[model samples]
Target: MLGIALLAHWLLGPPVVDFSHHSALSPIDMVATAHAEVKKPLTVNWQTLRELDYTTGKATPTVLNLLGTDTAVRVPGFMVPLDDSADAVTEFLLIPYAIACVHVPPPPPNQMIHVKMAGEKRQKVAWDPVWVQGRLQIVEMASPYGEAAYILTAVLVEPYTD
Candidate 1:
């Protein structure tokens, strides 16, 4: 009887594990779970942004990958207010250096980012560095300060800690 049971088990390729106790997630729940999994934003730097060749208008594979995705990113830089408000601004240019596009000539388009606050959100202009978190789009924007190769739809703007 044991030999017969072993033969039958081998032929049947083992019994399937039962998972019926757990309820299947609905489509909406699955989507919510996926979004939650990707909620953490990616920290990006000037070096990664500089991978795009402004002169040739060619982006490296790494830069191209970020173009149209819903990927959230956090970039640390200095803000040059595009709006007239002195205290707060809805739009600004984020640069790698503080003095850039001010005393010195503007950096290449790839080095600058035109950041637009989401909805009616206004960020106070910070003389010190800041971290801008948002969805980054590769779109050319011409500003009074300089031309930016990328545009960031800012979700949050905070003072740089380190």
Candidate 2:
């Protein structure tokens, strides 16, 4: 059943998101907002992040525009814990799909985000999906599980809702 679900998700692509209800900021708009130094958190999807080219270790113009900017963003994904703790989790990789880095091969670097809880903040590892809100930085991070092209210093971690 899990295999079938994975196959279906792969074939169908990411679930449809109503951007109109959110910031209505598309990938292009995200770059513009980044340049404008917008402080409001924008909703970012994995599809937009997947546009990054990790092979050359260089970010595209759009992704590059986001670097060093105070562009707060909210991204929803499953947590792949990096710490050994059974309860609290301070660092983890956030992947678009569940079982991405485990049961199957890890996704591309751009598809995974290295999430670090802000300051001394810590949250319990969530088996279900969660939304990580933070300032997104284009930094290369390596973990025992996989490499990530982006690092998010998360300020808030909450369960994902429709």
Candidate 3:
């Protein structure tokens, strides 16, 4: 009788869904659904970037309108560790280009994301590439080198293949 009950529960129980992390929503689709109001991951366009003040390096707040706000998203980028290590990182900057913050002048605010990874599972920094999944917040952050228009509290990390 116990065995039969267990089998029935296994077959009829609600599907186990992991609620601990963001769903697998593509960045592009997320933006499409947002319809320009702050709702999802938005692609940074350097071409239309509002030039920052050179002295203050202050970002024009107008771009903040395009921000994804407090929305879940996944983005693929190269890690630029702020923890000061190339092999491991807990806090880092994710940029559209691998050499973005390291070699050249960091791009404008919208072009980068300040990522504070969750927990002590320090992610191994790699030049290969990675996909960061988490809730994105539209906020301006200042660093010595550059500014980021958004910050993400990463919940999932995965190696990028393409």
Computed on alpha carbons, the lDDT of every model, listed in order, comes to 0.82, 0.79, 0.65
Output the lDDT of residue 154, model 2.
92
> TM-scores of all models?
0.75, 0.72, 0.56
Tell how far residue 13 is off in model 1, in angstroms: 28
Q: Which pairs clash in model 3?
A: none
lDDT of 1 by residue, 55-159 (tens): 888889888756555678899999999998979999999999888897547798999999999999999999999999999988899998889999999999999
Query: RMSD of each candidate?
Result: 11.6, 12.1, 13.6
Worst 10 residues of 1 by lDDT: 14-23
lDDT for residue 38 in candidate 1, whole number 0-100: 57
- Runs of candidate 2 with Cα error greater than 4 angstroms are 1-38
What is the TM-score of candidate 1?
0.75
* Candidate 3: regions farther than 4 A off: 1-70
Off by over 4 Å in 1: 1-37
lDDT tens per residue, model 3, 57-82: 45566444333435556778888788
Question: Model 3 scores what on Cα lDDT?
Answer: 0.65
